[model samples]
Target: MKTIGQPPFYSSFFLATVIIALFLGISSFVTYQQTPWKAPASADAKKNPLASDAATIAAGKEVYVKECQSCHGKKGKGDGPSAATLDIPAGNFSTAATQGQSDGALFWKIEEGRKPMPSFKKKLTENQAWQTVVFIRTLK
Candidate 1:
């Protein structure tokens, strides 16, 4: 027979497990929400070889359409279909915060993506990544 005052052993264990899981889940969410996705100072210093060139910008548009449009939207508004499903919101490139960043900083971000954003360091050639930064600059 079980005692009236005390909970069963399995029930207590299950409650404890649930509490711990909840704590971890909340902690992770808070941490992820608080962290900023900033490139290193070294990365910020790295310049784009093809900065603002018309042809490079055009090439970058093609790459953005093929690779980034799904997550960043057709106009870089961060309102893509998949944006609804992400834990972190997709960046709005048209915003001043994004536009204000240096080309190198933007390039570094594209090369080394954060969670929910795939890194293009391996997937895209250096030229292509730099070109993408050029295309992003045109988003208004």
Candidate 2:
């Protein structure tokens, strides 16, 4: 049934739903385009002072479990319990995109985090940060 001057209620609802879906799709694409989590050239040039020895990896594992596991997952897969709520996704250490990054770049990202990730510069020491990087390398 249709009124002369009014569109059907379902048509209006459908149109609104379509608009919302389009808006959300566009916004997600825009966000992805803007979030280029790349470390600077200088950061890439920096080095990891700690070796990936057993002791260092052990220490890194401890820190990661305490600080990063909530968002990065126990296995560094970026599918932690809280990952679903984030505006930007966490880095998945198992991926080649992550494994290919230099140690310094990973260190920089951990030290100076992006919007959803907090900076660890003050929370963790340089040694600990490097140790975490070592642990990350083992994720692959």
Candidate 3:
């Protein structure tokens, strides 16, 4: 038996609620799209690690040529062939301003490249990444 004030089993109210929920979802999505992306804490500049030797640098350089030169440039000056067409732009390793990065910071950046650049964490070994960090510090 139905109650005195109860409506029928089918109702327009259900449809309205779904529509409102979808609209709110889309609005939230649009707002999210407008927000800018921030770098991860690992990318922080303060924790940069330094490399200690010529051998490490040389090893890093070899890795760079094989893995990074496409975007980071031959000397890390960010003049590589692909650098010109990148939407976000590549890093300039040759400049002193760029060289000011800490070793750990550089290592972090290489391990997890910013957007557009792929992460080498899986492709390259941790040691290889550190070697590359050593090479990057020499880019003056």
Which candidate tops TM-score? 1
lDDT of 3 by residue, 4-48 (tens): 877754666887888999999999787645443334555665442
Error of 1 at 121 (Å): 0.9
Task: For each candidate, give its TM-score against the true structure.
Answer: 0.81, 0.77, 0.62
Residues 23-59 of candidate 2: C-alpha lDDT, one tens digit per residue = 9999989977665678888888897888888999999
TM-score of 2: 0.77
What digit string (tens of lDDT, one per residue) describes model 1 on residues 25-139?
A: 9999897685877778888788889858888889999999999988899899998878888888898999988998888899998988888899999999999998998999999
Q: If both were scored by lDDT, which would come out higher, candidate 1 or candidate 3? A: 1
Question: Which candidate do you rate higher for TM-score, 2 or 3?
Answer: 2
Candidate ordering by lDDT (highest first): 2, 1, 3
Question: Between prediction 1 and prediction 2, which has the larger TM-score?
Answer: 1
Per-candidate Cα lDDT values, in order, are: 0.89, 0.91, 0.74
Clashing pairs in 2: none
